[model samples]
Target: MRVLGVDPGLTRCGVGVVEGTPGRPCTLVAVGVIRTDPDAPLPDRLLRLDTKLTEYIARFAPDAVAVERVFSQHNVASVIGTAQASGVAILAGARADVAVHTYTPSEVKAAITGSGTADKKQMTSMVTRLLRLEVAPKPADAADALALAICHVWRGGTQARIAAARTRVEEKGTRT
Candidate 1:
């Protein structure tokens, strides 16, 4: 399955695309950062993010979009900006008729590095190894986006199967 992962931020939103399935090695389809000027008006920044996210969704044609869930932070401004960017990304996925899933920072870290408390350095190292990249994706954000994608591919695929099985069982019961 193809998954697009987004690490949303006002200044620099990370985007990564990966294609893989559970118990299989994933291939990196693309990775980049969407940058918006901090000085730009809030509406303008959101517009920029929306445009880039829509383009990425169209270009990648992902089966699903995985976004970093916004969490509380000491800096209210930072949290607001991130939540806004995340909203735009989620909207883009919805526009494209793609399912958008949100994962907490701890969930993503655990999925990629096997530790909920893994630091950025550890997550980056694991992402590098998982993708078999010679060098880590730069700007931490980029690596994080890739990690989110990898996490979705690994976990989301299994979740889909479980849901499908439950649906089948429900249908069978209804017929009986």
Candidate 2:
């Protein structure tokens, strides 16, 4: 399955695209960031975010968009900016008819590193090691994006398998 993972930020929104199921290697379709100058006005940044995100969704044509749920509560400004960026990414996914799901930081960490309280360094290291990536996904935000995709693929695969098995059981029972 095609998957697009997004790490939304005001100035640099990270995105990663991969195609595959869990335990299997997923081909990296594309991975990059949408950069907006922090000096620019908020509206301009949002516009830039919209344009870049739309382009990404169109280019990758992912089945789903996995994004990190906003967690930090210290800086209201930071939170607001991230929310806007995330909103634009979601809009792009909706436009492309892609299912969008938001996962908490803990969920992502647990999925990627088998720990809900994983530190940034641990998460980064785990992502690099698990993906067999030559270099760590850079700019922290980008790594987070890749992590999101990996998390979704892992969770989605499990869910799908369980669903298929349940369906099979139902069918067999109906026949009996």
TM-score of 2: 0.90
Candidate 1 lDDT for residue 171? 100
lDDT, model 2, position 119: 100
Per-candidate local distance difference test: 0.92, 0.87
lDDT of 1 by residue, 1-176 (tens): 99999999999999999999887888989999999999989999999999999999988899999999997862686988888888999999999999999999999998988899999999999999999899999888899999999999999988989999999999999999
By TM-score, the best candidate is 1
Superposed on all Cα atoms, the candidates' RMSDs to the truth, in angstroms, are 1.3, 1.8
- How displaced is residue 151 in candidate 2, in Å? 0.5
Per-residue lDDT, model 1, residue 50, is 95
**Residue 42 Cα positional deviation in candidate 1, in Å, after optimal superposition:** 1.6
